[model samples]
Target: MKSREKAVRMTLVAASCVWLFGVPFAAHAQSRVTLSGIIDAGILYANNSGGHADWSTTSGQLTASRWIMTGSEDLGGGSHAIFRLMSPFNVQNGHGTGRAFNVAYVGLADDRFGTVTVGRQWDTTIDTVSGFASNETWAGYIGAHVGDADNTNASFKVSNTVKYASPQFAGLSFGATYGFSNQAAAADGSSGFANNRMMSAGAAYARGPFAAGIGFLQADRPDAQPAGALGAPGAGVYDDYENTFSGSIASTAGVQRQRIWLAGASYQFFGALTLGGMYSKTQYRYLDATALTLDNYEANLTWQITPAWETGVAYIRTSGRYSGSGTGDAEPGWDQINLGTEYAISKRTTLYLIGVAQQGRHAVAQIYGVTPSSTRRQLVVTSGIQHQF
Candidate 1:
């Protein structure tokens, strides 16, 4: 079956190429490819990182800096062959964060059939509903939920995957993805196949300055394991969801199974102001007799004072609970506020400032990519510049 599918895709690409270029297989020049990238950096100060005021230089302040190559070959019948390769990097040290082609994929596209791509890619939730959150839009990860429990700002990707995106119809579209485990036995000499998969799907609608989306994602055996376990020579779960706030209270190591669902919407008024909000629920089932659940609610507003200047503010509340098999239950809630502004130096360059403050009740505060605070409250301020090429 897999081989048959591969053959079909190849045939489609070949047939489309022939029809688009109107030339023999060996002679065609109807393809276009382009390279693009963004570079962003900032000075960061945290009032209480691990109990000390710290200052440092950071990358990806406004956006995670990355380069990409995109190409498309026109197919005769309103169809095309497409591919993209994206590489994210850290400017502070001039190092690539992951694989060279961390977001690489090749696929076929058509106006009527949408697109189908294979290989590593983002899950459905981030692709669909994350735009409604300020964390993903204006404030960066500094405004994201702790540990990125919903995968909005985390280092999570699906491998060995096939994804489908539906063409828009009346401002509505949908997508789905499945990641294969591609593994054998577990580290503990158990069957790993039962708990080694990931799946996600989502839908979105946009019309007349209003947009909304709903999404869901789930993963099995998401917890980290001991070294040389799970048929791999590692101490972490195979295909693990990487968390930036590891060692903090928001870490996901205790989770064995994970699931998340989200809904979000946005609206623009008078062509200058925008309002948006998102709600998400994340559940973590642990092997240590503990279960964790988080409910995140957020709202934000953005104002474009002029073509070159913009500002925004956002608020987020996280309500969480922990249940132990025999222990007890606890409620840990958190409130966060985000403020930011941007001034465009040119069409492809901008300067920005962002501030985040959070107060936790019965919870610990940790901003993504920064050290956790020792107390229940934390603050971070950053100023940065970004350039695109």
Candidate 2:
């Protein structure tokens, strides 16, 4: 294990050196490094959660507060080397106790060929079709589909991954990624082929005022590891990634595998209004059991009332189906509405307001990062501020 760890570390060091110093001998390359991030916090009111009206201070209601370091160097021949190191934190507590870099990758890019990178990073749903989903694009995790089952809001990042993105061709682009377990055998010294692995692929199109995307993702054993294991140093399988949004199926629900497909599209009108819609289906296959399926539908509109002010409203419907051995089929559904507005205080700062109302039928209400409601209804209202640099 130590030998493997040392090897991976050495490889990363070499790659970093190449990206930093491998410029052409005489081309006079130019390099740039930028520091950037967002900080957001607010007060939230919930009508029902654990059977009570609750009020609390919240962080990342509009965006996950994060800091990032991004750099790129021109390598001549229209190619460039790039890298990113991003860290996410809770602004309210000002503590970063988990993984050091939420995203860490090194890659090369060319206008004509494409780009390839390796590290912990987002999957295809987040890269492609998620852009048209209000919960992921604008409304935040609080507005995400039940348990974020489809990964539009990204339940977790893929670790030990290599990714490739193709250059656009006539308004079309495509990308894919693979995640590894980093271990050769299971605890019992057997092949770990079915333990931990992830893969995703997606494509997108944009032309004039219309854009659309489609994506597919599959992940195995996201929560196979126990708690108190994610924050440890060195390399581990599935432990280094945070799967906070996967509670519905990943938290001892006996889920063994997951698969998702999503598609979305949007249209712009008169440079002031945008309309978008998305659809997704996620399947949860359990160990020694049948499977569960979740279907989600969403539509939203964003209106730019002015250059500094904007508002968005969206509606979502989610349905779940259960199928198991010798068991009757059961179906449950949930409906949600989300409303939000943002006023730009400056180019890098804003004040925001958001509200969501959800109701479930033959289901329990569960919003991301919030306590599950005892009844079938939940409502959340939040007012906050965000700043970027």
Candidate 3:
């Protein structure tokens, strides 16, 4: 029965693509599949984790290391069948927590129209806005904005999604996504239709030395589908990352809804230096009429000091306010700085060092993917190697 439903859903998605593109279907001929992966490993030192100084080996400092397989088949008329499968894992012990395929999707692409994909996938925000956010993009996961409240780091992906990506025209492109509820009950015993659905949209433009992007997402009952949070222990998996949104307030009944909106832009100078900035807002709405709102303001500068050496620095200010709870209202905030330098030994291997410092107000200091500090201040430093294939 479940297989039948999935087949029906996939068929509808293909049909929608055909209608959207208004192209006659042709027999698929050529097929190609590519397998690629990245491995990142490092050693880390932190001033505090649950109040204790710690040393440990870490994985995926720059990005969650993952194995990926992408395939495409020519279907004629400038349209094709495409699919992707990816699994992010820790390199240290070779363990990952969550769906076996963190990313699993299949779709149809048309050169004249757009592409449509279905299955578990990313929302538009992570796809569009993350490029300008250094902390969440290239500076390492620890640079993520206060628990990745804005999801620029893609701490979580939406399930049961149908996504569209428009082709670029004059350096401009836009896309949207819809995630089915795929469940029947909300935390407050409500209809699945009343919660658990999701929608997102994004747009980007890159011309000359300038680039910009904007995106937004709304998820009613984010946890209606069972998925482990990335970087945390789940089932038999060990702790690989602790990167949850800090602005969320969870009760026994759970968070009711989530909404995020973000915008970012960047400009390059002399083809050597680049400056970028971004702003984001995330809201965790609860069934008890309570809500936590997080606002992030960030900026970064990166310099290509040499053909093989790259360096950057970034700062983030994140503030949050919680209201409507029985315990009354509270405000929390964090100010963080990140610095990084990397040397590319060759095209596929690199050596890097990263440092982070954070100060908290009305909250415990916690860096993304690390244990929370007992106090309001914390520091983390890591040096690592990354290899890509």
TM for every model, in the order presented, reads 0.86, 0.86, 0.86
- In order, candidate lDDTs are 0.76, 0.76, 0.77
Lowest lDDT block of 10, candidate 1: 1-10
From the highest lDDT down, the ranking of the candidates is 3, 1, 2
Predicted candidate 2 versus true structure: per-residue lDDT over 1-78, tens digit per residue: 000011111122334444665843332347666566778799999888799989999877887777767777889998
Over 33-55, each residue of candidate 1 has an lDDT whose tens digit, in order, gives: 56667788999999999999999
Q: All predictions: root-mean-square deviation over Cα?
A: 7.1, 7.2, 8.1
Candidate 3 has its poorest 10 consecutive residues by lDDT at: 1-10
- Candidate 2 residue runs with Cα over 4 Å from true position: 1-29, 225-253, 325-328
Best by lDDT: 3
Clash pairs (backbone) in predicted model 3 = 231-241
Tell me the TM-score of model 2.
0.86
Per-residue C-alpha lDDT of model 3 across residues 256-328, encoded as one tens digit per residue: 6777899999999999999999999988876667788899999999999999899999999999888885635
Q: For candidate 2, what is the lDDT?
A: 0.76
Deviating ranges (above 4 Å) for candidate 3: 1-29, 184-190, 225-251
